[model samples]
Target: MKITLEKVHGSMNTFYMVDGEERDDYANLALQLCAKDQGVDGLLVILPSNSAHAKMRVFNRDGSEASMCGNGLRCVARYVCEKEGVDEAVIETMKADLAVRREETLMDGIETYSVQISPVSFQLKDLPMEYDNQTTLIQQAIPEISEEIMFSAVAVPNPHLIGIVPEEIQKSPEHQKKWAEKFNGQNNYFSDGVNVSYVTKVGQGIFVRTYERGVGFTNACGTAMTASALISCMSDMVPFGEVAVYNPGGMVKCTVNKSGDTFELLLTGNATRLSVHEFQWEEEQVDSEFTAFEILDEQRQYEKFIEEISVVVEQFAKRKE
Candidate 1:
């Protein structure tokens, strides 16, 4: 396992990318390094590109495969920008065109990298929730759950719910576990599956903690942020426009709008680099190093690039204000 590693920083978070199938094993080492230094916030393992196809899978330090990751994108973007010496770059994923840009960090000793997420769309049919075409008001309470949470399924590529809980509910271990269980199960709202997000507001910004489907509880989820923000706007919790989302891990800003018959979302967050290490493995006669590729046309990539840049400009403008 000849593995290469890169250190990239986003916001205040640092991540390590292991270019080999032994990502989980490497990620554990990275986590230990972060613990030793006491600065690393998250760990992501990007699987090596396959021979026949180029694709990557992500895993958090806890050895969980996240359905979607926003912060990790910035770390990868930094790798491309610094290694390739290009301010603007595109990372092809299995799902969407991740248009990335190098940005100045607001906080000292931190680097800011931004990546635009796939546009958001809400279709119960598309999400494949339990609800049918006619069911509009889903006020059903999940069985064996006490939070009285309501769920709305949205896809930025994963199923998620915008669980609205009262502010008075103290965030105890009991409370967190209670909601997490309900979100993971196939309740009356979503039979196929669902990721549960518990939301609250701190000042003008909205904060969330996600119980992801593929992965358990996590500090932040980019897709969940977009879905929760959209649900907030639709429920009039927050006005339509750009929304500031605070997750347990950190903050990610989301923008949403209506397009034709669906809602679109743009999720922005920071990423960072952790460490680089070589895998202790022998060389292959036919292989050089682990590689991955994504198939995206130039036109689509350029369009996404422009859109993401525009969002970065918006963030800069907000700073000016």
Candidate 2:
């Protein structure tokens, strides 16, 4: 059977969107297609929602499922909007029904989408973290990683551990990779594993690098960035406003708000449509071969956008020095 798919990315965290089909082995399909060297980061299966506009299911590269993915949500929103020829849409995720809107274009041909990342919670049960009687994990010391490495855990329905590292440590790619490896897995402190973000404060923005739970060392993790922004605001490091979150992939803006015990998060970034392809699927195989794959040639436009942002980042880094 021929299946249509779209390769999309938000803040460089890519996923393949496929129409929902009656398949019992979607996990295996996600594993085959989400390989870094072959496919993308994960798969988003579009489903029909009776109460909402559309429904989406998120699957990570390792055949594990996620409750929500902020980056993936943006791409799905764009997909739904374009397909329906609408300016806005509501996407029902596993965690919550999110509202997304088409914002001003980030670049020529590159559209920006903002998604509401909501119902924030810090309760251990929410993150389902085993932290020994702790209701919240905020800058707590975990001797496993380092007594010095303080982390804050939060769940926007997707669990994340945020670390505010020194600028020197953040600058070293090797350090970031090693730390991510140490804290993620069956034998790690987080038994269920968690998305880890190491962040550093820049002038008015923050630089973040993430090691996702199922997908490790991605160019960016949208929820991780939102978690970092929330932690920054909690620590009074950043004002309650749009926090510029710069990842290795590109930059996304997160607006955070706190009112007493309630918190709200909004993520604004590029929801890029990279390519479209049609593939053939067999019932017995784990992987599918594309019968007709076509690149949209938007790579050049995306590259230009990246180059322009790099110049700005370099200037910002230089000023900090």
Per-residue lDDT of model 2, residues 18-60, tens digit only: 9775467778767766543344788888888886778989899
- lDDT for every model? 0.56, 0.80
User: Which portions of model 2 miss their true places by more than 4 Å?
Assistant: 35-39, 311-321
Candidate 1 Cα misplacement greater than 4 A, ranges:
6-15, 20-55, 60-67, 125-128, 131-148, 182-193, 281-321
Best by lDDT: 2
Let me know the TM-score candidate 2 reaches against the reference structure.
Answer: 0.92
Candidate 2: residue 165 Cα off by (Å): 0.4
- Under the 3 Å rule for N, CA and C atoms, how many clashes does model 2 have? 0
